[model samples]
Target: MSYSATDMIFDSEGYHQDFLIDLYEKLLKPRLVEEKMLILLRQGKVSKWFSGIGQEAIAVGVTSILQEDEYILPMHRNLGVFTTRNVPLHRLFSQWQGKINGFTKGRDRSFHFGTHEYKIIGMISHLGPQLGVADGIALAHKLQNEKKLTAVFSGEGGTSEGDFHEALNIAAVWDLPVLFCIENNAYGLSTPTSEQYRCEHLADRAKGYGMESHIIDGNNILEIHQKLSNIANDVRENPRPVLIEFKTFRMRGHEEASGTAYVPDEDLAHWRERDPIVRFEQHLLDRGILNWDWAEHIKCKIKQEIEAHLAIASEDRLPEFDETIELNDVFKVTENQYFEISGEISEIRFIDAISDALRLSMRKHPNLVLMGQDIAEYGGVFKITKGFVEEFGKDRVRNTPICESGIIEVAAGLSIKGMKAVVEMQFADFVSSGFNPIVNYLAKFHYRWGQNADVVIRMPCGAGVGAGPFHSQSNESWFTKVPGLKVVYPSNPVDAKALLIAAINDPNPVLYFEHKALYRTQRQEVPFDYYTTEIGKASLLKEGTILTIISYGAALQEALKIIEEEKIDYIDVLDLRTLQPLDTISIFASARKTGKVIILTEDSLFGSIASEISAQITENCFEFLDAPVIRVGSLETPIPFASILETNYLPYQRFREKLKELIEY
Candidate 1:
């Protein structure tokens, strides 16, 4: 009497007997597949497996009830999620075998890959980050008025992460449609819940955030399916975040290799007696819906299917070690369509130029969103967005809570669904708070799964405002070494507006560094209309034959001032607008032309962008050089009060002196 999944039905007594068998079959797939993988692990046919023996009910029950349009973020243990989604069995086997056709193309192993085709994103090795990404997708659903929701699963231990708290708070405050599922499988790796948290239940803390919370029996398939169906439906319709704690126990080791010796004999026996799959099977038998012979036949059919797929996966090809693939997979660079700024040409301040660019971008891309701390009515700390909220309204111009990590992940989430997001950090120094998602999540996500998270982070960097240690720092160099992240900085107002607009149009994540000192101090004839400066291209400020001054941001302004005030000619000034994908062609040509070079930067002299430029010149243009490259930068210490002490610490303090020495060398 068992029917197909399409015919499954739920009534007051939970799923009807016919559909109950269907749910039972769904639960059996993960259990049987995990059992087969354990044998494969021992036989050296597979690398690793995270068993979900006792917790199959949670993944199967929740995923089975979810609509096909809804998205889900599943942890490694949730094989049932994939099986329920009907992802090809051969592909699942291929994924575990690290085949080229696998989701990550053998670049990653186990369940660390995501495919948009399935609407199922796998978790990173870092457990709690995906919760925030889920929030991003749900936020997109809410803004578009779509009746779609996203469900994300984490272990009982993952709730202890700062990301978990931050994601929940952001979701609740925004009233996003997200189902936060926590499967309490008792142990986090080796440690138990006793050492994880003091809260009676993770769900109990959700009410404090004004979010709905519930607890369920994770081992009961019927109860879990019934509760999740209603809860998922309510949240999907009303669009609010809900946290559900499903109580279960880890029946196997975290992985097969980790023995269960730590789990006392009595506890192991206790949970084994209440195994989710076993209980569900017994329930079918008691209801006279399934007999012992039919149950054995079902298990046999699952085993045969697993073995057949494993054999096919064994024949799947491995990815070749192509040198270009390593470089190419990091980012997908697209040729930008140049926009002509024919509106007006007026002298604009650096801050106004950035403001103008964002204003125009918002008007152009209706999906463009701005997120930061106190950026809405306060118009940001710099007042660059002073009238933005009134013009664009609050939804587009958002003032986020002080959760920098959450802010970045939410933007990442927004980017996943074809929306543009710009995240503003209060200060460049505070990027450390949100560095994980930027480097690990946003940066490598494309490399791992061929997905583009198109978001821009505007970093207000540099010293000289008397903002002191915490607020003042030139930290743009930090992201330059990270692949899949574009770094751009502009010297003056014209270039600042151009570069900001250009970064927004790029298909990858970009970090736009705005120097605090140059915000109001520098003014130039910037286009009032729309235009973009090309990334990875250097602008020649002044062309000369004697020598070249290589710099960017505030440092370039200081170099130009020295040349004009001192009445020096015969010097080439090149402002490198983009830091990553450095304009080496321009630098090499300039170095080869003059046979002398001076690399100036606001970051400290040692291990700075200056150091990188100097190395490139020495290696690529050694024969043409007449003088060793001289570099000037801030003294290696925390930025101090912008008094005489600060002046001495800045690169300008020695620009004139260094220029004189280098010119005569």
Candidate 2:
């Protein structure tokens, strides 16, 4: 059955002149900005501009119904939504100028920017990332018992993207508090809606996901305002996702510079006649609420306000370089003002720490979930998720395919939706296959969008016990080079437990580097309660007066072993749990104290974790060092299959000897 045009409008809310005109003007701001921004682009003052010329009513009318605290995830062309959110007009212009003071501080394109206080989620350059992110945020809100709704906007063309389907499907399955807003403006870039999809109504797709849905006239601002008012309120109260398709038209081309040569002349003419801002203005005039002169004055006032904002925004200083470090790259569970410390009740292995951390985090927060290859019923190869499937069910403990890229992609896609996905890469050695998704895609997602993924990648890493090179290598250094990825490698059972809890609680994409050598071999008494080991802080296992042994993962055990064997009374040991936001403060402080240093890892010596550490230490604490920092790691060769060769291929015992040599030197 077709939805009548009148069926979309809500008559209860008075659509008076004041309200209608405000909606019309809000819709026009983006179009006007796009026009001017394009002029700047043509003049070489700006690089690109995405115009929201035809879908104004959808952004303005829908956003009008939302509260200031409700979250909005807008797509490339939803600049009008930001206009309603009170984003400064000049900041929008500065973004196009590629100025430091721009919305994304000159880091990302004008379309993808963020402002947390306004509760506006940033846009994703890719079509469907925001859909999943909205769901995740909504899930967080639901779990926290907050009355916040997450609304994600996208174009009709974006509906064809795989992420769109994945996000909506998950949102429905999870029953997240989200509003999936589709601004169907007849065409996507140049492709007509009919050519791209066969769905009779995009909103109907919601039926497959068991979600409530509606199709509305995008040109009718009053109808949009009235319906969204009720829908937003309903979502706030009940907290279930809804899909709304706003049938609208695009008056202008995709961007300012393009002539829109592919758009049919007839289709363009048809949409121009139904311009949403013009239609809404007429609606107000028809009700004897507004006049031509009054509308003109309003337009003039808006233009002046925009110009004044732009002038001031252009002058505002850009974010300082140090401001990027403000957010804690690693997250941890906190019960109160202090990190919840767990005491040792029983001796535990590395894998047990992982399982306990996951169980504790899930028990504490209902929003947490575990997913990856065989992680559900299989409990994962390492059993880090042993009983999660039974405890949380299949929805939370997802058993995914062997597609490494797909696993990370789906996890990343879902993280964007609002669920906390703890992805497992069977072994650390195989992590190379999933590196692109982690480095090029997921790692950069936060930096590109001014948003974070808040997901954990549990990779059992390092070499020992004859697992061979294929199952053993520690490849965390590869991820550490990426700007936004947080790398964590716990040394002891307690730190491992605390770090895992922190990684899940954190709102950033973190690489949880679990040493395969430590998974079952190393045992330490760990507390049952949850706690966090700070991401960028280093824990000094023992403080000494003479030399320092800096290491993490399996090497920490080697350092402790050597200290015991040599009866080294003045040696200091440090465990670096988080890398990326490397604990430089602790490292420099240790170096200053010891005056001698030895950095160790189980990976290849060249470009290893130690290499970066050595260079930074040399640059920062050069004067305090008595001698240049020495390092120990495997030789540049594939870890052999045999036990003897594997032992020789790793650097566990070698690092201990190297640290002694560094102290003697």
Which candidate wins on TM-score?
1
Q: Lowest lDDT 10-mer window, candidate 2?
A: 328-337
Candidate 2, residue 350: CA error in Å?
2.6
Candidate 2 residue-wise lDDT, 1-665, digit = tens: 22333343334244465655566678777767766666767788677767777777788877888888877878777877788888877777777666666766666767777677677766656666667667667766765678878788988888887667767776676677888999887777777877988978898898887889998788777778777888988888888989999887777677766657887787677777677666666656766677899888877887788778767866876556565353432222233224766454788887798889999888886767676778888888877788787788776777754555545655654565466778888887777766666776677666554556767898887777677768877788788877768889888898898888888887778899888778788888888777777777888888987888888888778778878888888778888877767988999999999899888887787887899999999999999999989888887998787888888877767776776677678
Over 4 Å off, model 1: 1-14
lDDT of 2: 0.76
Q: After superposition, how far is residue 144 of candidate 2 from its true place, in Å?
A: 3.9
Candidate 2, residue 224: how far the Cα is off, in Å: 4.3
C-alpha TM-scores of all predictions: 0.97, 0.74
Which numbered prediction scores highest in lDDT against the true structure?
1
Q: After superposition, how far is residue 524 of candidate 1 from its true place, in Å?
A: 0.8
Instruction: Judge candidate 1 at residue 282 and give its lDDT.
Output: 76
What tens digits encode model 1's per-residue C-alpha lDDT throughout 1-665? 11122222223264467788888899999888887888889999899888888899899988988998788999999999999998988898888888887888888888898888888988988888899999999988987878999999999989999899999999999998999999988899899988999888888979878999998888778778888888888887799999999888888888888977889898777777777787778768877889999999988898888888877887899888888987898897588768876778999899999999999899989999999989999999999888999999998899888889988999988888889999999898999999999999899988898889889999999998888889889998789889899999998999899899999988799999999999999999988799988889999989999999999999899888888998999888999989987999999999999999999999997778889999999999999999999988999998998688788888785888989898888
